[model samples]
Target: MLSGIENAINSVFKPISDAVSGFVFAEVTVFGVTFPWIVAWLVVAAAAFTVYFGFVQFRAFRLATQIARGQFTRPDEPGEISHFQALSSALSGTVGLGNIAGVGVAVTIGGAGATFWMIICGLLGMCTKFVECTLGVKYREVHADGTVSGGPMHYLRRGIAERFPTAGGRTLGKVLAAGAAVMILFFGIAGGNMFQANQSFAQLRNVTGGDDGFLGGDGAALIFGIVLAVFVGLVIVGGIKSIGAVTSKLVPTMGIVYVVACLIVIGTNITSVPAAFGEILSGAFAPEGVAGGAIGALIVGFQRAAFSNEAGLGSAPIAHSAVRTKHPITEGYVALLEPFVDTVIVCTMTALTVIIAKTQFWTDAKATVAAGGPTPDGVTVTSESFASALPWFPYVLTVAVVLFAVSTIITWGYYGQKAWTYLFGKSMLSERLYHVVFCLFVVVGSVLTLGSVLDFADAVLFLLALFNIIGLYLLAPVVKREMTNYRRRRREGEVVRVK
Candidate 1:
């Protein structure tokens, strides 16, 4: 019955998925290495932002840390959440399966060399986050009820109009903003909610004996989905404040736990550390037997980094916009830390663990790919790597995966709700209806394969970067002006420090 349902859904959606995928992932060959044009688009934008901002990721790294720690935050700020909470909310959205499974996929396809490129892409992406998030705060709407709504929709519409201040500018802003909102809502359901739910269920089922356990029963997934949705609904019903509070605690605890687990795996194989680093560095430049050679690795790395940290996608700005800060650029500075933590630190740790563990999963995955077989499941490969060290670690990984999924779902719930309100009126009925529909999709995602559905969602997600990056470029000057003023104020002791 579940298989039939999945097939029916796929039948209805496959054509739509194929069309969007073709357009969004159109490939272009550069120097005989073919890769998605969208990946290059995102990388180019990040690179441009990095250069345009004078490497703000480096110059303001310490300042970002200070501001995120609440050192420069005032209690009377208008936004709903503190700097740390806002960062945590944003981090929870990005630092999920992408860090664990996605890294495994990267190394399997692109070799260990991909890890090097992932780090580099993540570093460059910091500036993109800085730019977009600055404008998110700058153009956000603070409602009479004190709720904040922002992201690419707000920035694209309002920032663009403010920049041009003409009828044409306003029309362009509205069109771009509408496109962004629609894409956000679509991806929030498909990628953020459904994909996470499906993967989390897969991980749970695997850990529970892979079709032999009680959870492998026909109705188990439905039950799991409902329970998950209930938890998410609880948090999201309270809106961003509730999400901020939960994520502020949950993100740090989960991150520290995951990082420590990775450290243990690496520490147990301490002798292999130097050799693993050597493989990463060497493979990055001259990978043997890998497709597209170094360029292949670079493409894979950039793709994974873009997918994992999502710096240019403009989703994080929504969460960051809720930060309680008078100076919008402070949140931008805090935002830069997101890609660093998600891709640079967490993802790098996962990659290092997989490399140091030296599991047979890699060899088998590579062989399967060479034979034109479907890519091996990333979660499985990652689980095998952890289990190679601690035989019981897969259970821990299950917990991590589920937590990651729930956190991602709730953050995206807020994102989608904001988009829904943007499109429809923000009445209580509309908000509740959106939440109900969102949760239903969570159940649907858990019960179904969602093959083409996921592809469609991913395509829409990248499509968001199209509208968002264009808006970012148009508003880059605004961000720079804000940054200049903030820096000048700080230097003149006009910005207060509480911590």
Candidate 2:
């Protein structure tokens, strides 16, 4: 029955996925090497924003840290969550399998040199996150009930009209805003919700003994999905406050454990550290077997960083906009650290672990790709790397994977609810209905293989950048002005400092 449902859905959605993929992942050749135009689009935007902000990520790093630690917090703030909670919630969404599996894929295709480019891209992406998150708070709507609604949808509609104030501007704002909302809702259901649920179940099954485990029975997936959904529904029912509170605790604990695990692996192979760094540097510039040489490594690195950190995807701003602060720029300052923590720190740990351990999985994966075969499973490769040292770490990796997926699902639940309310009007009935439907899809995702459905979702997720980056470009000046005002006020001691 599940297989039949999967086939039916795939048949219905395959054509749509093909069409959307063609547009979203369109390729362009540069200097005889081809890469997705969307990757180039995001990379260019990040670079432009980095220059426009005069490298604010570096200059304001201390200020961002201060704000996140509640140094500048006041008793009476407008938003629902603290800056740290908001940042943690956003990080929970972005720092999932991408940091683990995605990095494995990058190093496999682009070699160890890709890690260098990934770090560089992560740095540039910080400014793009700053600009969009600032605008999110600036244009957000705080309802009578104290709930916040924001993101590209709110900013594109409100910011564009405020800046241009013409019929053309109003029309453009409405169109773009609707497009963003639809994209968010679609991706939230498929990629954010279903993909996480599906992957979590897969990891559980793998650790329990693969196809011979207790969770490998016919009804096992359904039971697992129901249990997972129930846990997720409990947290999300309380909305952003609940999500923020849980993620504030969960993200830090999980992040510390994961990072510590990576450190242990790296420490065990301390002798290989210098050689791994050499391989990373050499593979980046003058690789022997990697495709398209240096340019290929750069493209793969940038793509992985963009997808993992989601710096320009406009989703993080939704969570960041809920931060409690009088000065919107404070949250923006806090927002820049997300890409750093995600791509720079977590992802680099994964890459270095695989490289330092001299894991054969990635080497075999590279050979397979070079021979025009299917890319190997990234999660499998990453797991193999960790297990090479610890021998019993696959169980730990499975636990981490499940926790990461649940955190992502919880955050995205908030994101999709906001988008649903934006389109269908904010009523109790509407919100509850969305939640019910979302949980049902969680069950469906676990039971069935949604091939084209996931493909369509992935494409729509990137399509969000099309609407979001345009709005970010238009509202860059507003963010700059806000930064200037905040700095001047700080200089005069006008901004309150609780600590």
Candidate 3:
């Protein structure tokens, strides 16, 4: 009966999934390598923003760190959460299963060389984060109660209009913003809620011994989904404040634990460290690992980085906008840390662990692709790597996965709610309905297969990026002006750095 339901659902959604996947995964051959256009577009955007901002990600790195540490924060700032809280909240959304599973997938498909490119993507994406988040805070609406509403919708609609003064231009800006919101709504549910639920549950099932584990039986998913929904539903209600408070703690806890565990495992296998890195470097530059090997790695790296940090997706800005800071640019600076922590640091760590533990596992993706098989599940690859080192590590990973899923679902609920309110007014009914649908999808995701869900969400993410990048291009001058004035104010001693 369950199999019948799963098949029916797939049959119904297959067409829609196929249509979306066409655009999301549309590939173009470059230098004898085929890759999705979305990956190239995002990588180009990241590099462009990095250059346009005068390498703000590098030059302001120190200041950004100081600000995130609350050096520039005041108790009575304009928003609901501290910069650290905001950063953690956003990081909570981005640094979830993707780091564990997605990184493995990238390295698997692209070879060890993909790890090198993934780092580059993260560095370039820092500027992308700065741009979108600066616009998010700059154009955010502060309510009577001191709440904030911002992100691409607020900036694209309002800032884009200012950039394009003509009536038609203004109309186009609103349309683009609305289009992005529509996509955001779907992605928030699919990727943020369901995918996390499904993947996290799968990880749980794995660590528990799969078919024979007490909680790993056929009906375990529904139970896992309900538990996730209950915990997440409680926190998402208080908006960014509630979510921020939870994430500020949760992000650090999980991050420290994961890092420490990886460190121990890597330490246990210290002999292979140099050789693993050698494989990474060689795979990156050598062209014989797989078909279009170096190029394949490059594509996988960029694609995974974008998926992991979501710098260009314009989602982080929503959470960053809620940060309490007198200087809007502070949060932008703080947000630069998002891609770094999510993609640069956490993801790199995961890759290192996997590469070190199971040497032969590095070729899984290339081998699979070369054989015309589907991309393997990253969770399995990552779990096996950890298990190889410490027989008990999968249990730790399972706990981390569940925690990551819970945090992601809660944060995404806010994102979807914000998007929903952007299109429909923030009435009680609208908010409640969005919550209900979001929770329902969490359950659905846990029970269903991921092929269709992933394709649909991936498409939605890229479509929203299209709308968002259009606005970013139009509003680039404004971001420049804001950054200039902000820097000048700091130089002239007009803006005091709060201790």
Candidate 4:
């Protein structure tokens, strides 16, 4: 039965896969550079919002830290998880492959310049996170079972029903919520679950050479699937507190360790750092100008950064919405840190490592080409860079990538499950069914070609953002109202209230 099911999925997805390949080659280009459309637009648009919001990502920095530290958390808050855990769970999702593999891709294609753009995107993405998360908490519903089910869908429907009484207004809200839920399911399954598993297995296989039967090649993915299923099942079955407990510990420890490693590599080749920055600044606008004029250089840099940070994808809000706090704005402030950690900090480390590796070992020309090539083997490239800089770097990076990928897969599984339950209803049986299917796909992703599925998933994520941003714009006043209220209370030293 399992073999037959795999065959059926393969046959069904083949045509979709072919069609995506065709699209990637045909439509995505800027001066013969096959750039990713969804990523490109998302970066540009997110930058614009950051600008329009007066660079809130920058302004909100200190406050975000305060909220994360529990300094601002009151004793009488009403929510499922704390601010710290929300950040961790969300960070788990954002910080996984994009930090390791995605950064490698950026440095390869965009040269060091892509790192700069990624920072810009991440910085701007904080504002986007703030808006959606605020709305998520503001309009969330606590079911009789004491579980929370809220996101763009709840906010759109509740916010609209409350504010916009017109028939068309109500209809639009429902449509947008349904659309976001569906997109989340599609994106969560493909990009969040399968993609992570595929990359993790590929890297593990590359290193271990498939020596163990069930742990070899695709078998590694299967084993990974089962392990991941057990861990996630254990945590998610216990609800938010369990997920929060794991992330609270995992996120900070892993995050800080990865950053410190990159700093060592950067310090070793300190001189090249300036030249790397110079290259990034010039190539961001005119890649050809600095790297002898290859449009792919700019596209590669931008696409990798955008993919890693996910500033405008609207997926982060789902995780952020779960944060426990009375003030929605406080959580928004915390959400701002997403891009800083994911893109600016983590991605910077990867790029610096890559850049320094090139200076120390590879030729200028080869490094340049590797920087812009597709399938640049970022994980390997990063490991090579570290090994050159540090004695035991490969082992460390391999472990980091594995952990990062595993945590990421589990987080995405939850996201997809939420989307599934939102659309199909809160059936325990259906949730179990999705858990099994999602786990099974992890193994499949390890063995199969996912380029097409990745493209489709990315498109779905971007589509969610497109719809989500619309709702955000319409409900901007509500965000402002909450922000103002939070500030007023903070100034007055009143007990923080949910209202």
Better of 1 and 4 by lDDT: 1
Better of 1 and 4 by TM-score: 1
Runs off by more than 4 Å, candidate 1: 287-289, 370-373
Q: What tens digits encode model 3's per-residue C-alpha lDDT throughout 237-332? A: 778999999998999999999999889879999998999899889988886765457877877888899888988888989999988876777888
Candidate number that wins on TM-score, 3 or 4: 3
lDDT of 2 at 98: 97
After superposing candidate 4, which stretches have Cα over 4 Å from the reference? 1-8, 17-37, 210-221, 285-299, 359-375, 443-451, 495-499
Model 3 misplaced stretches (Cα beyond 4 Å):
216-219, 359-374
Q: What lDDT is obtained when candidate 1 is compared to the true structure?
A: 0.91
Error of 4 at 365 (Å): 7.6
| Highest TM-score scorer | 2
What's the CA error at residue 251 for candidate 3, in Å?
0.8
Worst 10 residues of 2 by lDDT: 286-295
TM-score of each: 0.98, 0.99, 0.95, 0.87
361-415 per-residue lDDT for model 1 (tens digits): 7888877775677778888788888888889888898899889988999999999
Q: Give Cα distance to truth, residue 133, candidate 2, Å.
A: 0.5
